[model samples]
Target: VARLQERARLFLELATQRGLDTGLSRGSAVIPVIIGDSALSLRLADRLFEQGINVHAISYPAVEEHKARLRFFITTLHSPDQIRFTVDALATTLSELRQEALYITPTN
Candidate 1:
């Protein structure tokens, strides 16, 4: 649990420094990164799952109404490399999704 907390703190620091809108509390091992867009959150979660990484997303009624987020569970079994992988994957996935959204959204 101590190791998990350390890894989580490092991950959260890296993520926040990179400007990701993460909402997870530093005190908890479970990390919640705000996706803002529910669909994108689900899509990212699916992508991670397909890669053999079990992740979850919160949307709408599951959280506060109309809010969406991706939740990451940091367990004692997770190594530093694994945590780094998850964080990197999340950053990459989010960047790709944002780009796709920008392209798909109709311009005024």
Candidate 2:
């Protein structure tokens, strides 16, 4: 458990430094990042899954309003490389999405 927590700390720190909106640290095994868009959240989750990381995307109605997010669980079986890969993949996916203008915008 300690090793997993340590790895989670590294991931959370890197994610926070990249300006990702991660929720307050509770030292729990699950790390939650608010993605705002359900579609983007799911896509990011799928990207991570493709890289062999298991995560889940939570959308409105599944949780309270405005809480859409991708939830990543830290397990003892995960290696440092896997954690780094997941974070890197997340950064790459978001960057690609942004460059592609795939995010929704206000219709006004």
Candidate 3:
């Protein structure tokens, strides 16, 4: 689980830094973003399927196939030590990805 949380944080931070449109909304107009194919919104539906909170991957036409992902969550329910461990794991994973920019930077 620790591994999962870090990946989530890293993904979240990258998304914010890129200013990619959540694409989860109707009025959005930013770099397209997606999760489960209904736009990016994941509130009530998420809570209802708490046990199924797998990933937030984007779909095809709008995105590509393998690009799809499931989402994991972090909350008060998890301990700080656990969160930190997961963060470290995510950093390691991101470093290994090699082909993608973690975030959009000028000249990137």
Q: Which one is best on lDDT?
A: 1
lDDT order, best first, reads 1, 2, 3
lDDT of 3 by residue, 1-108 (tens): 554454445445545454433334322111233333332223323432443323333445544553333233545454555544443443333333322334536673
Task: Kindly give the stretch of ten consecutive residues in candidate 1 with the minimal lDDT sum.
Answer: 59-68
lDDT of 1 at 69: 89
Q: Estimate the TM-score of every prediction.
A: 0.85, 0.82, 0.31
Answer with 2 or 3, whichever has the higher lDDT.
Answer: 2
lDDT of every model, 2 decimals: 0.80, 0.80, 0.39
Model 1, residue 11: C-alpha shift (Å): 2.0
Per-residue alpha-carbon lDDT of candidate 2 for residues 1-108, written as tens digits (9 for 90 to 100):
789888888889878877777878568778888887777777778877887778899987896647778888888888888888788888887777666665566696
Q: Is candidate 1 or candidate 3 better by TM-score?
A: 1
Model 3 TM-score, all chains together: 0.31
Query: Model 1 residue 15 lDDT?
Result: 78
Can you tell me which runs of candidate 3 are displaced by over 4 Å? 1-70, 99-108
